[model samples]
Target: MAPAQAQMGTIFLLFIGISKAINDVQMLKPIDLSIEVLILGEVLLSWKPNVNPELESYVVKYNVLIKTPMKEEQYTTQNNSTKRMVALHKGLCAQVCAVYYEREKETARSQWAKAKLQAPPGANGTSITNLSCVIYTEASNNTAMDCSWLPGEEAPEDTQYFLFYRYNIHLEECQNYSRSHDGKRHSSCQFAKTDIQITEDTIVVIYVNGSSKHSTIKPFDQLFNPSTIERINPPMNITVALKQESLCAEWMKPVSVWPSPCFTYEINVSDWVTGSTKQLTVKDNSICLLTNSQSRYSVQVRAAGSDLCGNSKQWSAWSKPVFSDKPQKASVLLLLFLVYGALAGIMLLSAVLCTRFQLHRRLFPQVPAPRNPFKDLLSYNEAPTEGALEVISDIDDPEPNE
Candidate 1:
């Protein structure tokens, strides 16, 4: 009986040993589990391989962690959650961890990888600010101005920045000129390309960060004209005599002149008839002057200086032209006399009509004749006669003086 019991016990021990050895072999074999992180759109997550010989499937575990300069936050999965975790911001730095499993055994966790991360190139996420241009009086041209943006929290010290420029002549229309660099944390750069000559009503625009600002300047010629005449210094009343021949002309200056004149006088003649223009520079004011022969000549005097600024005063309005040939004096006098006589006749006719009207009003007055006050009241039988009055008197006196 003892031998039989020992044999059964040996068999039981062998069974237990075999079971333990099998479990150890399973644990020694590596589970085929691998993880890969992928970023798609807004969500970032990990994926596992399905064709591993050892693992029928994989159990993936993931968590998101945000690391900013000021603070950090961590989120985990719960309640059978299988979807990929979303990032808080595209510009913020983040990390993702992924774990792989095969059936009941945990295999491996992937190394944390950068997830949904973005770092702008410059301070304040912008390279340039307040980019503008103005007419620089020192440079005798236009120049650009700009300010640097403040540094962002996560940006590196060695980040690079690109500066761009565009000029708009009209609203809603833009033209790109050139681009430059803001090296080593510089905030602004003067645009060296703004050297073009600006005309009247020219609008200039500058752009930065996909936005724009504008300025305008008027033309220089409109603001500064060299042909403007100054006021005369000393007042003078001078008579100008003009004479015109077929193609030549002559003029006489005023008999009176001012002392210590600062400018030299010149005579300019423009003929509309022949389409010719001539100028004769005169050193002294003279009585007689000759010009090129022209049918119609406009004469004026100019005060000029030899300095760089050139002449300052233009001549007064052109003098009336005089024909070279004299007309018949007798005929001109006759025409004038006829005109005077006609005007006198008209005046005399007006006076006669007015006098006749007055006389008519006086001779035939508008007032009616005086009317008799008792005409309507008196009747032939009712009128008191002289005999009635005498009868009354005789009655009143009684038998008087028979």
Candidate 2:
């Protein structure tokens, strides 16, 4: 009796499974899945539902799958249409299916209907390549943007590229264009503070299209998040001071056109005495180290967007290095230099004066000489009287001879 009961149960399960299979086979799929371009990079996907009032009325929802050249996405909605922002340069493929859910459980699903959009075809390597962009957010909340790209390998000499971007509802063109290679083709573009608006929910769309005399230059488009591509300025007012036992480093966050909730900091401290270096990562703008002694230190601080704007991998450049007690030491050194310089100048002047006086004495020496003009005449007269005496003595001896 037990074996017969088991057989009956197995047959019942088989009947249910067969009935389900037949029901699924007869279920109709969604019809006429279509894509409509709302804007440059935004599109709408819509389809007609398979409506049958004879079937039990359960809420139907759609499952949408999007395939792009770079990535894929899936979404579920109760409506027959959905909107999305995506790059349209390479086109995309979208598929939608209706799912039947009863009592919060999936009861059945229909077949998938697919649609395709074909981008304007061109030569293989005629599209722009290696495009990059950056947004500069200053401390005063001023903003600017810069973008650059390289021409495709098969691009022609006369190929000129134009750039357009959109973040919110307004699409803007590049006005301050920077050209490359003899100014023949535009390779870069710049935007002023008034051109863009950025927020946490903003999505940036960049498009590049080109024209050439020889060939058709294929266009390229890309999507970006403002926070991810932003180049944050380094932390300002960075100062390190010695407070009691710890060397405390403090700074202010970078200013930008939009306010940021918080920031992460990197403080690199180098000990002048120990000849060692340290890397410190912190969430706040201030940090302190207990060096035990009053040893001088060198420090630099750099910052990045944090919290809602957090980007751990993208860090600003390190700030210029600041040293503990550097200002006092510099002033002392300068004062000593001035004092020593003045003393040396004085000594040099005295030495020169003494040397000049000694040189004068050696060039003109004192001598004992007669000052009277008639002294030489007196001497001549005395020398002549001696010759006269000798002549008189000879005359006296001549009398004896007579």
The whole-model lDDT of each prediction reads 0.40, 0.80
Clash pairs for candidate 1: 124-152, 148-187, 200-219, 247-293, 247-294, 248-292, 248-293, 248-294
**By summed lDDT, which 10 consecutive residues of candidate 2 come out lowest?**
389-398
Residue range 283-336, candidate 1, lDDT tens digits: 554435454332434555544432333333434333344333222333467679
Number of backbone clashes in candidate 2: 4
Misplaced by over 4 Å in model 1 are 1-53, 77-90, 101-108, 123-402
The lDDT leader among the candidates is 2
Against the hidden true structure, what lDDT does model 2 obtain? 0.80
Candidate 2 off by > 4 Å: 1-25, 194-197, 257-261, 292-296, 307-313, 326-402
Q: Best-fitting candidate, measured by TM-score? A: 2
| Native-structure RMSD, model 2 | 8.6
